[model samples]
Target chain A: MKDRGLPARISCGPEGSNMQYGFVTIYWRDMIRFVRFKTLLISSLLQPALWLAFFGIAMASNFDAMMAGMPVPAGIHSVGYLTFMAAGIIAMTTLFTSLFGGIVILFDKNWGLMREILASPVGRNHIIVGIALSGVTKSFIQALIIMGFGVLIGAAFFAGYAPLQIVIGILGILAFVALFALGFLFLSAAIAISMESPEGLQGVMTLLTMPIFFASNALYPIDSFPEILRVISLYNPMTMLINGIRYFAIGPDFYALGHHYAFTQMDIALSFLGLVVFSVIMFVLAWWRFRKAVVT
Target chain B: MVQPGPAGDDPIILVENLEHTYGNFKAVDGISFAVKRGEIFSFLGPNGAGKSTAINILITLLTIQKGRAVVAGYDVATEPQRVRESIGIVFQDITLDRDMTVWEQLEFHGRLYDMPVKDRRDRIEELLKLVQLEAKRNELTKRLSGGMKRRLEIARGLMTRPTVLFLDEPTIGLDPQTRMRMWEYIKGVNREGTTIFLTTHYMDEADQLSDRISIIDHGKIIISGTSGELKNTLGRDLIHLETDNNEKAITLLEHLPSVREITVRDTLIVLMVNEDGTRVLPGIIDTLRDAGIEISSINLKKPSMDDVFVFYTGKDIRDEGQGPARPHFLRAGGK
Candidate 1:
């Protein structure tokens, strides 16, 4: 037979031990899928703005009227309800986007695409880390869109701040958003790897989002809740994320909904720390699941 | 055609007493074999006969539950990363992402193996031509025909110039014409010096494509040899006879020196003959006629792979409307 100039076999020597960026490959493929699905791309970007436009406007008008006659502390800054919930909207969009980010993993597993990845030389942890990175990217995009659109529709985000402070505030919100998105994406990946079907994963996501979105202070204040729910909301990572968002977007001290909103530096720091801790735990969980997973 | 490696060279793949179980069911039960370098080896068996499970274990997709597997000189359990690096796989099912274009599918595989950009690009061009997929490079994988998808997978498997390629049922679900074309591509690949380990249920596939064949059933290697050697084990020729009285014909032929073995399938009697069937047919006909028995039908032919498979496995591999036709006798002992 003719040689056909086939490449020689790769030697498994020290040269083969060079650092492998397999996760980047995984991330690249995911981004291809993200861009290739036009409907998915448009819907994910538009969903957050629609929520801000319709829900934020209707609720803000009602809450702003009800709090018109309430007393504001002499030195405190009083903001409209639209401004208050704009931050909430950002956090909400991030929550929805991040929670559903790992759905791709489940789809790949079901459609047999995961077998190609698992059988390759890539480390299993790369899959988890790669998915988390892309999830964070999606969340960042959605959060930025909501921020821009929320301001265009009369929500006073970063109002009265110097240009430098606006940049800092945006970065701070993204820092919190990145940490929070990582936490949920890891959790989503863990659940997805363990699940057998897409329907089962969807059911679990619904079960989770209901308690997480409503129980936290995203849509309304959690202070007037019953004693048990108030305590639960205090420890909820969603509440921690919103705390960071409000502290950066709004001022340190603001009043709305007949309640005084004040965040000490220590409170913001602890909330940031809470997100870090949550994400770390979630990473460990996802890593464990990936290590245990077997795909053929 | 690629010649088999010399006897002294180490085999590309080695498995010794390898066993695996899922809960209480042992999927790969104590099977051992080796694939020499520069040759095509096949594991031929029916579905659920542990072919896929064995392939999965060799590819490092499943944890090694028991025994040892060394692929391309790396121990699968202790050095799976090295094994994975040295081998490529075409899984039983289509594993392509529907949205990714044909070019992207190959690109993704190259990147997963950490191929340099220039090499990845050049190899993609070369393989696109090799598989005749250049025109479909920009089309989505889902848009390609089933045969095209299988060819793309084969190209992807060759991206890193792996030492060994594992193909599990490569031409499954394709038309007959496409299957023949796929065989040519596989042979073309083997000629280029990569060892191939394939598993299939099609008898002709194993007989035509493999340099060595191992017939597996119920997670055990029942027999292994070249296709010629396997067919030779059933003797020179096979004689099929349908007589009014099969039991009497069997009784008459059991004592003949040329009749090596007799198998009864329904009313048909299959005789493995030691001499040429043409010479032996006259004696068998006279013997049956000397008695009151009369022959309803008769067929004589050289042993084919189908007959060899039936002789050993005692049943046809295809799952059609017909029920299992287990031969009453003639179970060939394993090597």
Candidate 2:
């Protein structure tokens, strides 16, 4: 509905030399598109908001001892467990949104729109970056909104933490988003070119989302579970992600780190590096896979 | 529709011994051809004739498994990005986001190519008008008719004003009138000197347009030439005489020197003529008359692109596609 006046020329390169053009504008234009698609936009937010409101409140009473062992200055978990759940759940929203957001990539393939994009003169990285940014921005917004909802409900957050926690939370969320974006984006392109039905996209999302969700600590802490479950949870990428959020949200505590190492910048840096390594590997794979997907 | 010039000038596209293999099936067997700049080249084949595969290869949608493909003088394999830059492709499947409007769709693509925003805006408006879709510019694409969606695809394909355009089964499932409307727009684009390359199975569509065509079957280009050139190369004008029994007619025409080939096709003894049709008509009439066969009807059909296809490959083009041929039918009477 806004005035879309004469568009500015987004030169692919300097003038002369039969320069190619138009890639940057499409990327920017897609950001506006992220706002227009209501169903897709809301679906990202709805999942987390639901978990925060209904599940967090309903399940908190059950998580009492789970919180009692938290070993905060408070003697028992009490309401603090629910609070811990709230912060962790909000971060998990980013995981769910960005990972499965690759479903959109598959949708693009099935409809043959990816062909239109790839056929253009635009650089492949430009397209990849644009979609990644949108997916991250969508997840980040939902994460923040969920955070607010959590506080409003008296989520029992263990506060008095330093302001630096914001950096940790944001960096952690962005890193997780980048890693999932790269990983699932590759998978989406792979599934897309081969996909014959809309069901194929759904089937793939179903296959991926569950493993990543239950294997992580968003729903519960790692130590409460059995030995095998604890090992699996510790190794799970989302486990590390939720731990990062947990440490930042609740100051150093025994519940998350199993010791006083809770607020260390070291853990944040390690998690960030791990996610970055995963991101780079996935990115290279996606770049190669997409190049193959487009040409095939 | 005729142009007077040497035919061998720098062809806008060139493919040499191009081949693709998906396991044991050779979808495109070593085939070579070229299209002159500004010529409307059509790849006419039944559904599985690998027409789509070839289009994919040319547009850089599929990789060439063997040999080489060059478009606008850029090697598709070695310099695919450049090849992508030079061509615009409209796939048979509707690829536009149903959630995005016509204007938004074009703008997103403009940014993909990093068009100077100015050029992108001007091009979008020009194309919206070109497709006669300026009125629906802000409307969601989901509301568009089958024909309108196709027109949007053409507009989308041309947003970058690609030097070469690849349309794979553009009109697959529209009503007759809409099909014709699509053809009209396609012709207009071709007239504007866009080197148009498309693939379709509709017999009439192939005959109606296409300055040149390549007939592919099971991944091999069995034949390639202008429609007339390919038709004339069949070396037979069909003579359909009203014969109650085709076997008797085939036997009669088989021994005749002027008759080149005869086949019982479509309940008619289709006779191929080696002699000039004008000269041989009376003699054939006299011969049939003496046989006590009353002439119920007589018709001659210079081979259509369909005939050229049937002559080279022993199958119809429409049998193709796990994809529904529905969209192709939309263009049937559209032209």
Candidate 3:
């Protein structure tokens, strides 16, 4: 029989440490990775900028009826379809930015980078938190940048609660980031490991990305869709997110929960609660699977 | 009669009845081994040998199927979190976030171990110097070469100053120059009194670095001993000669009392012998010549890990890949 009772438990120096600082370490690396990859920055400006310049203008003439059908809330007016489109565009930008960030986690898995983190002394939950925090950070910056572009294009809202709005925006970004990152992190880690192939990556992306982006309130309002399509859109978590962000950004419009000049704090709170629950579930499931992946 | 080492010193690591299976295939069979603290223990096996699986279990990367593993007094399965908290692992593939610079990557790992901010800074700096990549601290890991990236990984593993450092095929793909440097780094880490448990298929590597090595085959520990002791246990030195007529050569060589084991094939005669090979070389050649056998070529090569593997399993380690074996998880849960 061989004895593998390896002696030496790792010493930071001459003294033994009794603390938990892995979260900070993991978070720092994750943030750096997200920035260095440059995925969000390029997509952030390019996609939304294109939508504002081309989609909002070229199709502006045809979208009149589409805008007319949306019930404009009190004290808010859509002089053109582009005005109605801006909120959805902004929300879509956050949705896309947040959702696509999920795939990058899969990319990391394929490259064996995740194994490095898994093998570390870092707690599994901290690893999830670090990645989620980075994802949330990227989603917020991208959403804010898209909002700036919208403002440049004459998109106006009831400019009163800037602090509350910023807080709401952050809360929305966190909600979206937590849900998308956790779900996708679990998915990507699962796929890369089980398949261990990049060939079917695009198929997987389309399978997940298409349904969320199209079926949700990204391109059109949920009310404008057919009966069956409306049901699908209304049920989607992305629907809750896109609608919530829009109401907060422009305040009570056809998109608002009520036909009044007001924003619902309860809606934002609901999305937060929903996403937090999802984030916890997904995070726990992914961590458990990963902890068993390459080590044993 | 065989005598074992005195058990006066408690083992640094002890694995009892370790086994891992994926479906019907047994990647790591019932294997057991112990590593002493401050010792460089190498798990030597070829391509499909359960080396990686074994190391993974030790490091807590792969879950142990049916066994007991204790590292620095921490149980691997029950206290996996604590096992991970204490162990440092340098995986075979690139594990550092390639998007970040060397400093950022190391800093992140230091924090993962929960090292203090001030302590993390000192650890990262010390690690950079230890891996000889302090100058490239600011450079992105994506821009580094294979060797530099490997060194960076080793440095990252040490960021935690783990009690037992696990390395999985650490130098498999590196160039010769890089492999030598990596070997030195491994030696240097071992010298720091950090116990290292590594897996590799390279026999020369096992001979050069390991204070002791365990030979694993098909998930089983066939033999475990130091480099010299294992080779000595073979009882004779193997002299594999490629000649024109293997049959006639073996027939003549079989008479020599010095020859303990002999394997003959088409144009090769592998003779495991003791004493001087040259003392009987003259007779071997004369007997072949008198027997009208054509001597086109004759080359003698020594037995090594490969020979040792074949001697036990009746198959070469190089052939492990071609068969249906493939890569199997050799040990328990991950690092």
Candidate 4:
């Protein structure tokens, strides 16, 4: 090591003055990492588009013929399956992306970077909230990409709505997506903290995400399921979230296919409020688990 | 640079009855010590002797469950932010972000502490130069060698220019040359008025560097003093005498004022001497001859730090197999 006669002191003006500095530093660190990897950005955008291309079209092709034999429900029709699946896929993308967002924290824990951050002068709340905010931003951006791709493929279901209604719809979708993303981000963080190794976390992610995705109404209407599964889907938060997205973005009349429940304003509000409460609970749980894990 | 007072007045770090537990086991059992400003103090122990746990508590990484720890004038439990601001820590485990460049890692740490942009740049440049890592500033940290990564960690720890620095096993797996170079950098940093709290199992490193040393074992401090003082706890010199008749030599030399203890093994009579074993060698030779015992060869050996460790802990620090309590996720000795 050579001596370059660098200044000895590093000025850190006051104790509480730079509290926000920790938040900005953490947020920028995640964003810079996100931007630096072109492959990550490309891959994230590509997965949902492929799901829309393969799954959306495959289901749409069979729906008209399939509905000809069976009666169309009161609020849904066979022709609108493509539009319905598009909205559902957007919710699924937000759900999956946010669920895995805490992989960053898992890496930090294993590599000891989390310990470094925990030992710093920064407030613990800032660390958790900063990561959650970044997850929300990433999910929101990806949701927009899905919408753009859907319109590019000539779905144009959103084209029918007025500009103001579109703005209102996007706000509702953003609110629902943000809450949903935060809930899963906290869930992932909670699991990552208790986990000793990344392999354990990986197993949990695989086991949980599939059941969470399939059991909900992201791919099908809850009423179409068997009795037991119908009860499970009715209470599954993801089902409520998908229902909220359909009401706001796709309009109330096109809410579900062969569904038993009516799409009322009360239902939409309750779904949105349910997610908010879930997010807060998970956030508190994650913060508590984080404190216990880092100490040991 | 504040000039600290004598050893007992206002230590930079003060701990009293600190305790920590893991389930039913007490990892740190009510330990207390003080470190003066600008002094290099070390806690020497084997792998699971609670050195890292105590350090974790002092640096505010772990909350103290049953005692008080004050670092740089703030209580570790109540004023963790203040404690964190006053100290910098280099963990025993590697904590660098592999994807980041060396410069980027330092910049991020500086930003976390809220340094002004130009000051952060200047400090990073100086630190890179200090660690001799200027050329590797733009290279990803994962590409650096084990030694280089250790140096980068040190540079990052110093980015905030903390009042006190805690280094946990700073030279655990480095090559000899790198270890020596790191010592030079550490001494240089200390000379510039930073109080250093170091922990390591390397006896010679502690012996060579620390002004005060504390030997901890089984969650309790067995002994604490300077290296010389600890060595003196055993006799100052060891005398090995090869004789034709060992029993007679032991009988004749057991009463000598200079000798502390005498034991016979095979054809050799080993004597623990207090001081000037060489000056008393002729007297012993004459006495052995008068007693009709032939002295073949005589040798005097000064005690090393290993002997000091053995004197206090009853086992060599490096020789004891690691305990089951310290479970490393990554393999040890892999850097």
Candidate 5:
């Protein structure tokens, strides 16, 4: 054979820090998939808007008529039912989008595509971080769409705020959305990696979404919930996220559905902290699952 | 013949007593071998022969159950990152994402290996040209034909210019012409000084492509040598004789010193001769004639890889009963 000399050596240093940004690669590939499936992309973006249009309008009209004669306490901003549940819609959209985002991992695993990444030099944590970032990005886009649509459809968000406060409110809402999205995406990834089939993952997700979506304050007020459910909602990450969204979107105190809604600064901070702790715990769970994952 | 690299005879991959088990079933049972730095080496085996299991361990996909393995000068168990960085892989099945374009697939691989932007772009261009997929760069992977997908996978495997490229059944499910063309691409890659570790069940693939062949069966290496050396172990020539009385012919030729071994397949008696067939044919004909056995057909030829494989493994590829052979081993402890 001809002397072709040695193969070209890789350019990375011995420390392999150049590969440290490998999560960016994973994120890029995922985004490509996210956009490439035009049907999936458009449907995911449109689903939340549809929920606001049909479900939000339908429920708001009935609930508003029922609460029209309720006495509003002095010095309290009395908003319509649409305004109340709009924040819930944003929370709901973020929840659903982020929870299903990691289904890509299950699909990749089943199709043998994950073997390429699993055998690469990229750390396992990078895979989790990458999926989490992309899931968060998807949630951000969906949340923004729902916010814009909700406002156009007469949900009284940013009703009396200055431009500066509005910007801060939007940022605060996104902060909560990011944390909540990260938490569910990490949980989804953990389950997806451990599952052997997509059907199993779909079943688990269905089982999870039932309690997570309904047991919290997304659809209506959770104050009337039974004692057991009230305790569960108190600690629910979904409730924590909605609390933050409402505190930022609406005023600190408001009246809706004949119920007085008040959020203290300490309450908002604690809600944010709840999401932080949830996402951290989910991240650790995902990291442990990825470390134990063996794909061949 | 591939010449030794500047590293002299230092092996690029070294494994000692490598064993892997799935629960109580042993997939790879105490196999040991080494691959040189700049040669194509093959593990020639049948289905369920622990080929994929061993490749997965070497690629660091599966945890090392026992023994030690070092790939590209890095311990697979301890320094898997270094090992991963130093090698590339083309899996047995088509692992390409159906939705990804050809360009994106290669680009993704380059990024996975942390290749610089400029280098990734330039290499993508070069590999697209090399694999003749430049025209299909923007086409989705699912749109490409089977051969094109395999070629694209090969290009992706070379994205980082890995020191050792591991291919498991690279040309599986391809047409005859495509299989030949795939072999050419593999040889061209090897000629560029990247040591290739290939596992294939195709006898011709191992014979024509690999610099060394190791016949593995039941999770063990039966033999290892160059193609010529392997074929020579079955003797120089093979003679096929169909006599009117096959039992009498076998008795007559069994005592001939030239005949090394004899096996019967239905009515044909196949003789493996140490001496050249041309000289041994006359003595065999006379012996059969003296035994009052009429010869219906007689043929003489040198041993092919098929003969060598069947001789060593004792399993006929054309037989339908080969499927049960593996499960039978699982029941009997694979002794």
Candidate 6:
């Protein structure tokens, strides 16, 4: 018979840890499942690419003529509408992927696998981090795939920046993606835990996210909006994220997407800092909710 | 062979008047018990008898409400992670990730327990072989049959090589052959050193497998002992007799030395005998025959856990589910 005691060579760390191995284990499981679900990859990638192709092209000419008459911000030349919307599409893809992350937890709860995890020696905080990290990773990769589509379609904004700048921009996009994703993931997880069944959460998420999507500057220039919507979009976190990407990826002059165009050094720093704070707060709230939840 | 900690030493699991409530409903009332190291101890009860709730508290899954529970030398509430590290559970509900393969499932569990990479691979292979699922290693869990899923759950529970394994109705719906095989696997595991605490309503399973059993009813442990002890408490044999003259037969049999207590049903007379039922069956028949009573039929039945349950609870465990609690004395009258 084989040795039945604790495996002789097994050791994951110096001692049994609180979260490291468990976090990575949960993360790896999510990644494995993420890779296996080819349909998910295809659909997530497809929708953003279609948005870039259809809406970017269909509306570009009209936007181009309209934009020529407007004052161009300092430090940048005129730009095509396609490039402006490419970043928005990237943000949208990130939102969509991250927003649905809690569906996996819902499935786990429905399938009773959450109890298996709950009963494990892993820390509850680690479970939250593992799941959140996995969701952020998925959202980042999905956003990058859409960005790849933007590159293939020859969005002039991408070609305008140096290769190093583009890579840095992708990293910047990931930060924004992580923030947006974490916020939505937290909201989704909270609703999932409190709601009786998953059937209503999806409808609720769509209703919740659609307002956030349309109320911001994602699909259109915030400057063109009515006074009240302009105020809403001005303060909307999505607008801040898109604005941060606009300036960080292309240049500060590309902040022309919004009514409040010029961003000082502090403006850029504070925007991302706000995202960091929001992400952290969302994480803390989500963890608290998760700990309080009873998985029948 | 790996040996367990000495028998009758410190208990591997201990509970002291543990209580839990779902709002006002007492799911697990104040019940206390201890399981010896390396013993197959079972909590026997019908549906909703608080078996799962108790197991959940012990496994560190559910929060303990009133009293204390210690598993593997750690308080369940205070050191839940330590308790969790020392235990594994096969839940009554199937908790498999249906999208994943059996290998992936075991690997995930091994990783959670922080097993090293090489050791994890080896253990996964061994476990898959043990469960006879090596051939289906790549098959997704959802594609597996119910029996296969249960086997995988058992294998996953062992992936961590836990010291205490909690099996909550492990063989609830398996076929007889599968159940026997499951028992063999469980016995083999226990022999190798793990202390097993299981909960099941199957009397035969408790009778055949457990070193001791606690019969739980309505959140309280009514009685607990070895199978033989429990059966012996209910007396040796229950003799059922059918006769044309029920009143005359009851009058005549009431005075017999072997028969301790006689309870009359609508048409059948049940006698709790003080001796081996078969030993005194012929003598009782002869005495009754001399009394000119025509005996229609007679049967000598050994006391089972079912009888023990009825004897202790004063009601059928199955009947308790249908309505509110009846008066204790009414049930004690044994209708």
Q: Order the candidates by DockQ, highest first — what do you get?
A: 1, 5, 2, 6, 3, 4
What residue runs in model 5 are displaced by over 4 Å at the alpha carbon?
A: A1-16, B1-8, B244-248, B318-335
List DockQ, one per candidate, in order. Answer: 0.46, 0.40, 0.39, 0.37, 0.44, 0.40
| Model 2 interface DockQ | 0.40
What level of docking quality does candidate 2 show?
Answer: acceptable
Tens digit per residue, CA lDDT, model 1, B179-284: 9999999999999999999999998999999999999888999889899999989999888899999998999999999999998877779899999999999999
Local accuracy of candidate 2 as per-residue lDDT tens digits, A185-252:
54454455446677867787678778778877777655667888788776666766666666555554
- Candidate 3 residue runs with Cα over 4 Å from true position: A1-24, A37-42, A59-80, A159-199, A217-219, A253-296, B1-7, B236-256, B280-306, B319-335
Q: Which window of 10 residues has the lowest lDDT sum in candidate 1 chain B?
A: B326-335
Residue A197's lDDT within candidate 1 is 91
Q: How are the candidates ranked when ordered by lDDT, highest leading? A: 1, 5, 4, 6, 2, 3
Query: Tens-digit lDDT track for model 5 on A89-146?
Result: 8888888888888898998888847988887777677788899999999999998998
In order, the interface RMSDs are: 9.7, 10.1, 6.7, 10.1, 9.3, 9.2
- Each prediction's fraction of true contacts recovered: 0.76, 0.73, 0.69, 0.58, 0.69, 0.63
**Which prediction has the highest TM-score against the true structure?**
1
The CA lDDT at A146 in model 2 is 78
- Give the better candidate number (2 or 4) by TM-score: 4
True-vs-predicted CA distance for residue A273, candidate 2, Å: 2.7
Taking chain A by itself, what TM-score does each prediction score?
A: 0.93, 0.77, 0.73, 0.87, 0.94, 0.86
Tell how far residue A26 is off in model 2, in angstroms.
Answer: 6.9
Over B1-335, each residue of candidate 4 has an lDDT whose tens digit, in order, gives 12345865788898999999989999999998888988999999998999999999898777679888999998877677788777888989889888888998999888877788999999999999999999999998889999999989988889989999899999999999989988998999899888999999998789988888989888898888888888777687767788888876787899989898765434556677888778878888889989998778887777677766655666656557542332112111111
Q: Candidate 6, overall lDDT?
A: 0.78
Tens digit of lDDT per residue, candidate 2, span B1-335? 22333754777888889887778888888878787889888777777677888888887767667888889998877677677767888887888888788898887776665567899999999999989999999999899999999999998888778899888888899889999999999999988889999888877777787887777767777677777777777565666676665566566667779888765445555566866676777888887777766677777666666556655665445444442322111111112
Off by over 4 Å in 2: A1-33, A61-79, A123-127, A156-158, A161-204, A253-261, A291-296, B1-8, B234-237, B242-257, B274-279, B291-308, B314-335
lDDT digits (tens) for residues B103-180 of candidate 5: 999999988888889999999999999999999999999999999999999999999999999999998899999999
Q: CA shift at A255, candidate 5, in angstroms?
A: 1.2
Looking at model 6 chain A, report the run of 10 residues with the lowest lDDT sum.
A1-10
Predicted structure with the largest DockQ when compared to the true one: 1
Judge candidate 2 at residue A117 and give its lDDT.
68
